[model samples]
Target chain A: MLHTVNKSPFERNSLDACLGLAKAGSAILLIEDGVVGAIKGTTIESKLTETMQSSKIYVLGPDLAARGLSEDKLVDGIQVVDYGGFVDLAAENTAVQSWL
Target chain B: MSEGTIKKFMYVNRKPPYGTVYALESLEVVLIGAAFDQDVSLAFIGDGVYQITKGQSTSDIGMKNFSPTYNALGDYDITKLYVEQESLTERGLSVDDLMDIVYEDEDDDWAEKPSIRVVSRAELADVIAGQDILLNF
Candidate 1:
């Protein structure tokens, strides 16, 4: 399954909640304000790094740019994708779970 | 569509309308997704129950009132609308306070049937467990 988290970790615990319920091998795509978690040197950076060990982590490219975050600011190994890539992830996965 | 497999898609609306754009944008996604001919369902829980409340007038708020769009879901063959009973009661709302949404069933000779199903929180949990895809807003 592909889990999309749209809330910022600073505003809510949705990312942690999603990580708790997401199974191994499931993909996590951060969009909207959720891209804040992908920034390097943030408090959640280590948590996101640990999460990538069990599941692939992705951040929406447009959302990142919209927030004025450059690609280099993202944590290592966090893949960035566009809207088409978002659609492709949904099609590739058997299901999608969005954590608002 | 194609002979490809169809997955159960559920849109979970947990926020109220107007205060944020999530509710409206979620509706747009549902409308666009209707073209895929997938098994789609809308689940209203928490503040989401307010989205379908009747007498919604956004004229004073300077925003286009999109509440009526829920009425058009049946036409798109996206008629599985579930309202969590607990959520409504907590907000002091009843089914009577919601919009009257119905669909014409061709199998039943075009007879009109209610599209919204009021379910208990437990029942809604079961419904969530059965969904192949869940889009939360």
Candidate 2:
């Protein structure tokens, strides 16, 4: 399944949605202001990491690089995906759900 | 599974790149989709057009200007990049001032290949209906 999560407030209510829905073969695509969760060392990353422990959760690389967050700034385990990769992921999943 | 049967998604970008991270982040999701061989399209509307303005150098902001990577869309098998015509004029940008990439038009041979389409603001309805899915960034 494909879950499109773009809400910027990932640490609050939305976090649960992201975690609960992600399952084997599922992926979370973080868009919009949600890229803030891409930061590695923050408190939220720990939770995000645990929530997505068995799933593929992606943060837009272009969004991160555009906003000035670099690969170095990204905490461990967070993958910075490029535009091309995003399309491929969307194609692979059987379902695409957006958590606006 | 049939290739064309899958959902093709277009990201509606309406926010500025910095104040909000939607523009950049959405691009990431698109990449993921592409990795899975999905069809993805991108449209810039409102402040999101700010993402492709010319002469964007984010060095002083302590970050890299992502506008250049827009050129790399082809490398990732991502085409169908669209820019709203109304947004261009509102932002004081003419198509001539925009980034150098494939422009999608009905006459173009884009149907034969992965490509980007430049649409007018008025044409968004068609774009919305044409997609199997719609994502707003």
Candidate 3:
């Protein structure tokens, strides 16, 4: 399954809930305001890094760019997927879960 | 429309009404998407359950009460509105707290049918997994 989180971690617990509930081997794609969670130095950075052990983490490239976040600033191991990549991820996974 | 061409689109709403513009903007997108004649469904999770709650009076807040607009969804041929059961329970709310939103089933001689389906968190996950497109708010 593919899980998508579109809310800021600082604002809502959507990212936490998703990280907690998502099974291992699932793909997580962050988009919209949710890209803030992808930053390297934030408080949630450690949790993201820990979760990356089991789940594949991804942040939408356009959403990060829109928020003025460059690829270099993202947490290590977090892959940046573009719009086409987003569609591919959706198609590849059996389901797309959105944490709004 | 060909059955194969029509895709499953689910609009996920997890924000509170009046606090932000997300709930309203999501509703507008749902309405606009209805014109495309695709299989569209709406899921209200977490704080989003407040959006369809009954007796919403925004007179003091000075914001337009758009909760009633959900009732009009049936008229647009978009009636699948799923509310997460666990979200309501966590918020100390029940099915009765929600507004009465019903749609007329054309196949059944226009009989009135309930639109708001209170589903479990697990059930809601399956619903989410079934969608081809997801719009989060």
Each model's chain A TM-score: 0.98, 0.83, 0.98
RMSD of 2: 15.7
Q: Give me the displacement of residue B11 in model 2, in angstroms.
A: 1.1
Error of 3 at B98 (Å): 0.5
CA lDDT scores, all candidates in order: 0.83, 0.65, 0.83
Model 1 clashes, total count: 0
User: Ten-residue segment with the worst summed lDDT in candidate 2 chain B?
Assistant: B102-111
| lDDT by residue (tens digit), candidate 1, B4-84 | 899999999986666568889999999999999999999998767767876665543356778888989989998789999
Which DockQ value does candidate 1 get?
Answer: 0.02
TM-score of model 3, chain A?
A: 0.98
State how far residue A88 of model 2 sits from its true place (Å). 49
Off by over 4 Å in 3: A1-100, B1-4
Q: Would you give the TM-score of chain B in model 3? A: 0.95
DockQ (CA atoms), all models: 0.02, 0.05, 0.02
Q: lDDT per residue, candidate 1, A1-100, as tens digits? A: 9999987675579999999999989899998667757877666778888889989999987655543356876789999998898999999999999999
Task: Give the candidates in order of lDDT, highest first.
Answer: 3, 1, 2
User: How would you encode candidate 2's per-residue C-alpha lDDT over B5-124 as one tens digit per residue?
Assistant: 667877787776765567678777776667666677788875566566555545444554667777667766667778787765543345654556643334555444434456876687
lDDT tens digits, residue span A1-63, model 2: 877776554224565676676786578877655665666644456666675667777887766
- Interface RMSD list for the candidates: 14.4, 11.7, 13.8
